[model samples]
Target: MSTGELSDERVTAAVRDATAAPSMHNTQPWRFRYLRSEGVFQVRADFGRALPHADPDGRALHISCGAALLNLRVALAHRGLRPVARLLPDPGDPALLAVVRPSRPEDGGEGGGGEGGLGALHPAVHRRHTSRLPFTETEIPQALRTALSDAARREGALLDFPGPSHLRWVLQLVEEAEARNRTDRGEAEDLARWTRAGTAGTSDAAGAAAAGDGIPEYAFGPRRFDGRAPVRDFAGTGRVSGRRAATFERHPQVALLSTVKDRPEDWLRAGQAMERVLLLATLEGLVGSPATQPVEWPDLRWPLRDPVSGRGQVQTVLRLGYGPSGPGTPRRPTGEVLDIRP
Candidate 1:
């Protein structure tokens, strides 16, 4: 674990772990290059996969890349390597989201150091899936909530669990955004391009497909028979084999992840914090799904803030509870998304 240099096989393994991070519609909008001479991992944005209508400003794209970066860090830490990461390291190249170098020194088990904690979260990287099914009404323990909040704070972001009144208002904003998304031709086209009612991978099975990326029908959880969990319905009215309708929790537990500033760098940080919290949640025996409906719209985004304090700008809506973990969707092969320099 103390070995400073990484072999090509180890680098490939790290990139595989990084690609496991979730993205909007499973676009996997990220690329990685291992500079062998510099001993650095460069995380870049793949603009070719950008969702023009859903994320015109590339905020979500940056966030997705940040999530991948977090996974890469975790992978390195699990191997007892110190990952010193910098966000937006280069001013000249906007596509370079992050540059991570493995420091030579071993991380002491000191409380202040991040390496120990990140290594602890290594198992959750592959286990954490975006669960869209119904969750039990049982409340999450206060200690667990605090832990999740701390995870977010560690990456310079805030996790707010709204009260009943504020949650109702937030739900209203989601409904409004969903309504707008249904009527907007641009959004519909975007969804159609990234979602598949039949197999999304290459196979011809019902929920299976040959494609390496995109949301597969098998991963669509189930239809919300009668709850306001705010889960995105990828199927819409489209048909999928063996899809079922199920009742969800009456008062689903949700949380809002936000940042103090609304900038590109802030979005990138939020993405890392989002993944951190999610991985911690998974470790604590929780399953979750992301609902970005209100956050995606300019008009509704402002109202999503705390009604009284009006503090941070919300970036992600998370639904968490005890539920079945959704099936994993295929990722673009590591060879396709990674390049190794001589």
Candidate 2:
């Protein structure tokens, strides 16, 4: 723990905190390499776990990695260390999403400490889970909404709680996107590979639920018996035996998280902003889930922007409210995704 060096133990702990980030289908398509000589941690994309058809352009994959990068920053900041990060630092190396150097506070102020103030959100790193279950009809207070909006802004993104008319339009877009996914063979196959219910029977729920990756049966939440809530039915058209069906809220609250641009850097920023908003929401006693169906399709994505200003490209759709915290999803072990430089 010297001024110019970071201990192995501390770096490993930060990686563990970073892996707690949420990804599309829990794919967790990212790797970390500790550059001992440079005293920096590099976040790389693991294309093997990527959904080729669903995320052909790698937008979602980058966003997931961005979330992990954000967690890494928060973990280091909480330890009173400063983390300097660069996104897409090497143009030739596309997989190299970012490189973060954890520096001491008195090291001449090289890096901005990953926005330094994020240390307060360290606890929520593990407490926040994607609750797919139905949330109560309780509307989020205006103050909390404003706070969440600010959280996204601090990370260089926008979080918009669309009005009734806009929400209805967005819901229609989501429904259409879901229907398209239903018929797309590649999309279904990709989803099947990421969901465990296809291979896990009712009796073997324990084993399937223990998997180290993907969406488990236990975390699927209840069937949307009745409501406008946009819960993605991971089961697809297949039925899950013994799964309960529950009525969801009549009017679900949804937020559209977006960035000004749609490049890889923007995607990375959106992911960090997303984690910030989610962490803040958790601290405020709220559970959140992502509805990214519409954003996956190019035709559907453009319409997601605000009609008045006609700016901001939607990256992910988020649903937030009061409800039971969703079941924990597994992540690939640190060794599986991290490589240490000698």
Candidate 3:
């Protein structure tokens, strides 16, 4: 289909897929605006949903928007259009993270076709979820690991699967970060405001006001009673009446995603890279969860980088293996976040 034939329904569907991109605490911190006249979609950050304490510099916010941006590109590719994304298009407006224009494929037909193309991973857009549940001890195949790394590289980022010693040290940093968050008042408030308690899906009046954007109780997964996997407990110190405790993997297969430079543009690229890795993993029959607890702290985040190479900024930590996919979290309706203008 040509850009001239772009329909409102198509734009809305693409935005819906974009919203499925994971965010810090399921905040869904993004807004979409389609310029019908120009056939472009503006991806903006929703500061109202920002986590000031956890993401003070708005790095995570930008990453979240970047993930959505990648999904939008994938959605467009699946619909037989080629997506051209310009990052941080307007420096004057930092919130306007990106503007994506969908045009006809260069081949004058559907975009690239192959297991490695963006179109190939389009189905995983809706299937991918952040599984916080216990993953088995089975190690991911080297071939699959290489593919996941390539996915990150395609978007200008690096994905590293650390050795045993590095993995252990990274886990320790994650534990330390979690400990600090427990005592940090600001972080505590962020959690309380974004986490839903009581019945899994039932939201109180206060939660209703925010629409469906926070992490629901059911998606929190079981509390970590044993094992060393770096899963952040959204329950905090509070008690969830029926939440059961389970033992996570004794040896969790974790990976660190990083980039050469640390900037708004880099974070956005890292976010896109991260989502690409995730969608590919989902398509490969792997369940994964991202843990930013370590990266949220400056000191801990610094140590997460490679001790040998000592290059690249660690953006986020990921744990992947064979396990049940986590339940889908709440998302704001498409009408709530998208604006179309002629």
- Models 1 onward score TM values of 0.94, 0.94, 0.96
Candidate 3 lDDT over residue span 1-342, tens digit each: 788787999999999999999999999899999998888999999999999889999999989999999999999999888888899989899889999988877764325546567877899999999999999998899999999999999999999999989998999999999899888898889989998776364554345435587877788899999999989999888889888999999999999999999999999999999999999999889999999998988988999998999989999999999999998777899999999999
| TM-score for candidate 1 | 0.94
For each candidate, what is the lDDT?
0.85, 0.87, 0.90
Per-prediction CA RMSD (Å):
2.3, 2.6, 2.1
- Greater TM-score among 1 and 3 belongs to 3
Instruction: Please tell me which predicted candidate would have the highest lDDT against the true structure.
Output: 3
Cα-based lDDT at residue 77, candidate 2? 78
List runs of model 2 lying over 4 Å from the truth.
Answer: 1-5, 106-116, 198-206
lDDT of 1 by residue, 115-220 (tens): 3378788889999999888888999988889888888998999998999999999888887988888788888888888876666334543334457788877788
Off by over 4 Å in 1: 1-4, 105-116, 200-209
TM-score, prediction 2: 0.94
lDDT of 2: 0.87
